[model samples]
Target: MPERTHVPVAIIGAGQAGLSVSWYLGRHGIEHLVIEAETPVHAWTDTRWDNFTLVTPNWHCRLPGYSYAGDDPDGFMKRDEVVEWLNGWLDTFNPPLRTHTRVTRLRQGADGGFELTLVSADAEQLLTADDVVIATGGYPLPVIPTFARTLDPAVRQLHSEEYKNADQLPDGAVMVVGTGQSGAQIAEDLHLAGRTVHLAMGKAPRVARFYRGRDCMTWLADMGVYDVGVQEYPGGQAAREKTNHYVTGRDGGRDIDLREFAAQGMHLYGLLEDGRDSRLQFAPTLRESLDSADATYNSICADIDRHIEREGIEAPPATRYEPVWEPDDEPTALDLAAAGVTSIVWAIGYRPDYRWIEASVFDGGGRPMQTRGVTALPGLAFIGLPWMYTWGSGRFHGIDRDAAHIAASIIDRVARGSAGSVVTDGATLATTP
Candidate 1:
C-alpha cells in the first residue's frame, strides 16, 4: 500500500467551486489540497460544443476574487473564453492542485475525518482530511433514456456534450430531443447551419434574451429574481424540478424562440415518448408546450415591466411576446427513416451522483440535505449545486458566498476544535449547528 497522506482540508474537485474554497482557506493560512480526476479542463465543460457561449452575460462571471473585467459585460463568453476564465482563476490562486487523479471512494474515518481512496495512472494512494468539500457539482451523470438503444441502428445519436457543430453530425435531417437549454440551443445551432432540424419539446420554459431595453438576465438580477432561495422559490419543487428557462448567447445573445424556428420551417414536435423500429412516438402536446413557453416569456416581461414602473425608471416601453408560430395539430409521431433523420441529439439534462461519498447527508430523493453548503456531518459540505441556497448557487455570480461559508466553517473548526461555532453571514455552521 502506498503511504497515506493527510491534510487539514481536501477539496474533491478542481472546478470553480473547489478552487474558490481553496482560495478562501489559503487566505486564512489553512492547509488544503485540491484533487481532480481530470486536468486543466473539467470533464463536464470540456465536452461543450465548439460554438457554445454562456447564456448568462460576462458580467455574471464572478468566481471568488476573479471577477470578469473585460470590455463586454453584456456579451457572453465563447467556449474558449470560458475555459480561459477558469484557467485564469486557477492561475490567480495557484492552489496546491493535483490533476489527473480520481477519488474512488470517500468514507468517514474512525478518527472523525474523511478517508479518500485516490486513484491515478501510476498507483492508488490513500489520503485523509479533517474537512472535505465535495465541489464536483450537482450534475455528475449524463442522462440518456434507455429507449435510445431501441432506435434504428442506422441513426447516429450524440449527447449534447459530444456535439461540436452541425458539420460533425451525419448528413441528413437531425432530430433534437428535450427542449431544455441544451436542446433548444442545439436545435437552433443545427437550423442555422442549414440542417433540417426537428425538435422534441419538453416542459422547460423560455425567457427572452432582452426585454424592453436590457438583457432579461440583467432585468431579473436587478429585480432580485436570481437571489431567490431554493426553499423560498414560489414554484417550489415544480419549478426546481424543471430545467432552466431556455435562451441563447449566440450572436451577441438573443432569445431562443423555437416558435420562430418553426415559423422558419424547423419541424417541431412534443416530448419524445418512445423510440423503436426506426420510428419515434411523441405526446400530442406540442401546441400546449408552445403556449406554456410563451406564457413564461410574457410572464418574465411582465415582471420586468412591474419593476420598471415600481422604480419609476425611465426605460423604453415593455414588450409582451405572442407566439410567432403555433402548431396546428400536435405532432404525435415521426417515422425517423421517412423523415430522413439520420442523427438524434439527446439534450436532456443530467442527474446527480454522490454514491462515492459514503455519508447519510442525502434525503430520500438522494438530494443533499443542507443549508447552503453545510451538512449535518461536521466539516462536510457540497458546493456548486443549482439552487444550493439561492438561484445563483451553481453559477459564478454567487458561488463566492457559498465557498466563503464552507471555508469559514472549516476555519472555525480548526480554531476551536470539533465543538467550535462557525457563524456565516446568515447561518451558523460546524458542530452543534
Candidate 2:
C-alpha cells in the first residue's frame, strides 16, 4: 500500500478549474493536494477534435490573474495553445499534484472532513482534507442513447468525443446527428470535405457568431444573469434553465450557415414525432418550424454584426433564408443509398459522470445538487460547471470569479475548524446561515 497523506485542501481534476483553485490556495499561503486522473490538460490535448479552436477569442481568455500569453488577444487559440497555457500555468504555480492518480471515491469521515480513495496500477492510497474541490469539469462522459446501440453493424458510428478529424472516418457518405454547435460544425466539415452529408436536426436553434464585436457576453455577465439561479432567489433553478442551461456552439467560429446547408448538397431531416419509432418520414414544412429557432439564430447574428461594426469593418448582409433551409419537425425520407455515407457521427452533447463520487450528492438525473459550489454535505464543493456561478463561470473568462469565491470558502472552513464560527480575523468568509 502506498503511504497515506494528509492535506488541508484536496482538489480533484487538474483542468482549468483545478489549476485555478490551486493558484488561489497557494496565493493565500494554503497548502493543497490536487489529484488529476491524467497528465495536465488531458481533455484539451487528447479528447478534443483535431481542428478545434476555442469559440472565445484570446482577449477574453483570462483565468484569474493569468491571461493567455499568446501574440494576439483577438485571434482564436487552438487546442494546443490551451494545453500549452495550462502546462505553463502549472509550472508557474507548482502546486502539489498527483498525476495518473484517479480519485475513485469520496466519503465523509468521522471528523466531518473528506476522505478520498485513490487508485493506481501499483497500490491504493487515501487522503484526507478539511475541504474538497471537485474541479473535474463537465465533460466527464459522453451521452449515448440506447437506441443508437442497436443500429446495423455495417454502419460505422461514433460519439463526438471519439472523433478527431475527417481521417478518423471511413470512406462513404456521412450522417451527422444533432443540430447543436458540434453537430453543425462536424456536418459542415464532412460536407465540405467532399462527402455527401445528411444532418438529423432535432428541435434546436441554429445560432450564429455574434461574440466577436460588442462585448455582449461581458454585458450579460454584468447583468448578473449567470449568477441569477446560483444566488438564493425564487425560481432560481427555473430561471437558470431559461437563460444559461444549454450548450451552444460559438456562432462566430463557422461560416457554413444552416440556411445554406441544403444548397451545398447537404440533406437536413427531423426525427419522428412518435418517440419509439426509428423510421423517419418527410415533413416539407421545416421552414415554418424553424421559426422557433430564430431566437438563437438572431442572438448569434446580432453578435456577429456587433463584432463587424466594432472591428470597424463594413457589415455584411444577414444570411438570407432559403425556403428549403427552414426547419422541419418531420423530415422527408433521406436516401442513404444515394448519399453513400458509411459513417454516422453523433455530435450530441455531454453528461456528467458522478459514479466515482459515491456520495449522496447528486439528484436522480445524476446532476449534483449544490448551493453554489457547496453540496448538501459539508467539505465538498463543485467547481467549473457551466453557469455554476455566472455566464462566464465555466469559461476561461469567468472561472476565476467562482474559483475565488470557492477558495475563500475553503480558506474560511480550514481556519475555523468549526462551522459555527461567525468571524474570521483577516480573510473573506462564508457561513451556512
Candidate 3:
C-alpha cells in the first residue's frame, strides 16, 4: 500500500511558474506542496546549452516576493546566473517542496478533489489535494518534423534543445532550420566558430535591439505591449499561433534579422518543406517571409516613435532601420551532400503534453482551456503558458500576476470545500465553488 498524504493544494513543477505560485500561496496562508521531477528550474539547469543566456533583460525577472536587484538591469543573465538565482530564492522562501518527485498520474478524487500518483526513487505515494495547479510550462516537448528521419544515416541531426555548442557537431557546413530566436542564435554561434551555415526562413517577427537608447523590451513594457491580453489585442489569436520574434541576447543584446545573417555570409532559404535521400525541398517564400519580418520590425519602431512624440520624452536620436531583401537564386531544392552539410539542427518550437492529465481541461490542440489560469474545474488551474492571459504570461516578469490570480482562486476553492465539477457553457465557465 502507498502512503497517502492530503494537502490543501498540490502544485506540479518547480520552475519559475510553480515557485511564483508557491510564494503567493504562502503569503495567503495556504498549505500546499510542490512536486518537482528534478531540481528547481530544471529547464535552465539541465536542458539549455552551456552558452545560453536569457533573451529578456535582468530587470524583467519579477517574481511575487523576489525581484532582481542586481545593478546590471540592462544586461542578460546567463544560464549559471539563472540557476543560482533560483536556488537562492528557493532557500530564502523555503516553500514546501519535494524535489526528485514525479507525478505519474492525476485524476479527480471521489470527494471532488485531486488524486496524484507520485513516484520517486522507486517508491510510489498517493497524494490528495483540494486543488491542483499544473505549472509544467509551455514548451514541454520539442516539435520535430517527421521528414528528419528520412535523411541519410551519416547525417547527424539534433533539435535545438539537444544542441550544446559547435564543437559537439560534425566538422562541416551546418543547416539550421527554423529562424526563431534559438535558430538565429545557434546559426550565429556556428558561423562565429568558422563553419558554413545555412538558415531556413520562417514567419518570425523581428525587433530592433535598442530604440532611442532603450532596450526594445524595456520600451515594450513601458508601452504596455506586454500587458496586452490575447482577446484584447488585434490579430491576437493569429499572432499566438506564430513563432516568437527573432532576437538575440548575445553581443550585448542585438537585433538578429535575416538580412544581418545573409550579410554575415549565412545562406538563407525558405521553410524546409520535405527531405528524402539527402535532398531537401524548400518553399519559395524566402522573400515573402523576410519582407513580413522587416515590416513587423518597422511597425514596432514606428509605434515607439509615436509614443516618444506624444509623451515628449527626451530620448536619443533614433536611426531608422533599412529593409534588406536578398533574393535566393535556388529557393526550391538543395542537395545536402553537395552543400557540405553534415549536421542539421531543428530550431523548431515546442508543444504542450497533457497525457498525464486525466481531465477535460485541454482543447483539441492540447492547449489548456483556461481563463487567466482558472479552468472550468473549480480546483484545477494552469500557469506559465504562452498567452495564457497576456503577452507576458509565460515570461518571468509576467507570471507573477497570473500566479496571484490562480493562488487566490485556489484559496477560494478550498474555503468553499472544493465541491462541484467543472462544466463549460459555450465559452463561459459555470462553476459552483
Candidate 4:
C-alpha cells in the first residue's frame, strides 16, 4: 500500500460536480484533493455515443463563476465542445486531482471523519478527510437486469453507456429497451443509420425533443419548476415537484414521440407478461400518454414565457423542432424476427450505485440520506447529487449555484468547529435536471 495523505476536503469523480467543488474551494482558500477514476469529462471523451450531443443549451453550461465560452448560445453543445470547455476550465481552476485513482472503499472514520481507501494505477492508499464529496454523479455503472441475461444465446445485449453509435453495433436489426433520453437518442441514430429498430416500451414516460420555441429544459428552469429550495413558501414545493415529478414530462421533454417511430415502421412494442406462449402486443393509451405529455409541456412553456416577459428577463426566442408523429397504437413484444432488429438499446436513466461505500450512508433506493448534502455522520458532507438542492442543481449549466450553497454550508461547519454542529435530518432529495 502506498503511504496515505490527508486533506481538508476529498472529492470523488472528476466530472462537472467535482470540478465545481474544487473551484469553489479555491475561491474560499480551502485545501482539498480530488480523486478521479479517469480524466476530466471522461464520460464524454470516451464513453458517449459518437453522435451524442448535450440536451442542454450552451448558455446554461455555466458553473459558478465560470462559463462555457463560445459564440453559439442557443445551439446544443456537441460532445467535443463540452470536452474543450472542461479542459479549459481545468486549466483555470487547477484542481489537485489524481487521475486514474479510484475510490475502492469509504467508511466512517475515527474522530468523526471519513476514511477512504483508494487504488491508483500504480498503488493503493488510505486517506482521511474532514469532508467528502461524492461527485461521481448518477451514472457510475451501467445497469442491466438479470432478466436481460435470459435472452437467447443468439440474441445480443448492450447497455446504452457502452453504445457509441450505430456503426459500432453488430450487423442486424437493433432493439432499444427503455424509453428515456439515452434510449431515445440511440434509437434515432440506429433508425437513421437504416437499421431496423425496435423500441421496448414500459411505464417510462415519453417526452418530446423540444417544446414550443425553446428546449423544454429552459422553460422548466425559468418556471422555477426545479427550484425545490423555494418550497418553503406556500404552494411553491408542489409547483416545483409537479414540473418534473414523473418520468414523462410536459412536452415529453421534447423527445421524438414513439408514435412517430411507429408510423415510420420503427416497431415500438411492450411485453406485459413473460410467458412461454405470450406474444408482443400494442398499447394505444401509451402512445396517447406520450403525445399528451408533449401537449402539456407546450402549455407549460408558454406559461413560462409569459412569466419571463413579465419579470423583464430577456427571454430567448423559442426554437422549435418538428416532432415526428405516428397515428398508431402502442405495442408489446417486438417483431425482431420480422423487423430484423438485431440489437436492442435500453435508454433508461441511471441509478446511483453506492456498493463501494460499505458504510451505512445510503437508503433503500441507494441514495445517501442527507438534508441538502449534509450527512448524519459528523464531519462528513456530500455534494453534486441530483436534486441535492434544486432542479438545475446537478446539471453543469446550473450546478455551480447549488455547489455554492453546499460550499457555504461547509464553510459554516469549519468555522463552527465541525463537531458541535447538528447534522440536519429529513429527506432532502430536491428535483434536479
Best by TM-score: 1
Please report how far candidate 4 places residue 32 from its true position, in Å: 1.1
Off by over 4 Å in 2: 1-3, 211-256, 272-289, 299-324, 327-329, 332-338, 417-433
Summarize candidate 2's per-residue lDDT along 139-160 as a digit string, tens digits: 5777666666555566777987
Residue 266 of model 2, lDDT score: 79
CA lDDT scores, all candidates in order: 0.86, 0.67, 0.84, 0.66
Off by over 4 Å in 4: 203-216, 230-255, 271-285, 288-292, 305-330, 417-433
Q: What are the per-model C-alpha RMSD values against the true structure?
A: 2.9, 5.3, 4.6, 6.2
Q: Model 3 Cα displacement at 38 (Å)?
A: 1.1
Better of 1 and 3 by TM-score: 1
Listed in order, each prediction's TM-score against the native is: 0.95, 0.82, 0.93, 0.82
Against the correct fold, how does model 1 do in TM-score?
Answer: 0.95
lDDT of 1 at 83: 85
Candidate 1: where are CA atoms >4 Å away? 41-45, 237-239, 417-433
Tens digits of per-residue lDDT for model 1 on 1-433?
7779899899999888888888888877789999999975475467888778899989988876678989999999998899887887777867888999999999999989999999999999999999999988788788899999988999998888889999999899999998888889889889999999999999989999987889999988998887787778887644446678999999999989888898999999988889897889999889888889889899989988899999999998877787777778878889999999999999998887888889999988777888878999998998888888788878877888888888887888888855446566632223344
Q: Of models 2 and 4, which has the larger lDDT?
A: 2
Comparing 1 and 2 by TM-score, which wins? 1
Residue 24 of candidate 3: its Cα lDDT? 74
**Candidate topping lDDT:** 1
Cα lDDT tens digits for candidate 3, 188-282: 78887889998888878888888898998899899999888888878966556767787877767888866876877889999889998789999
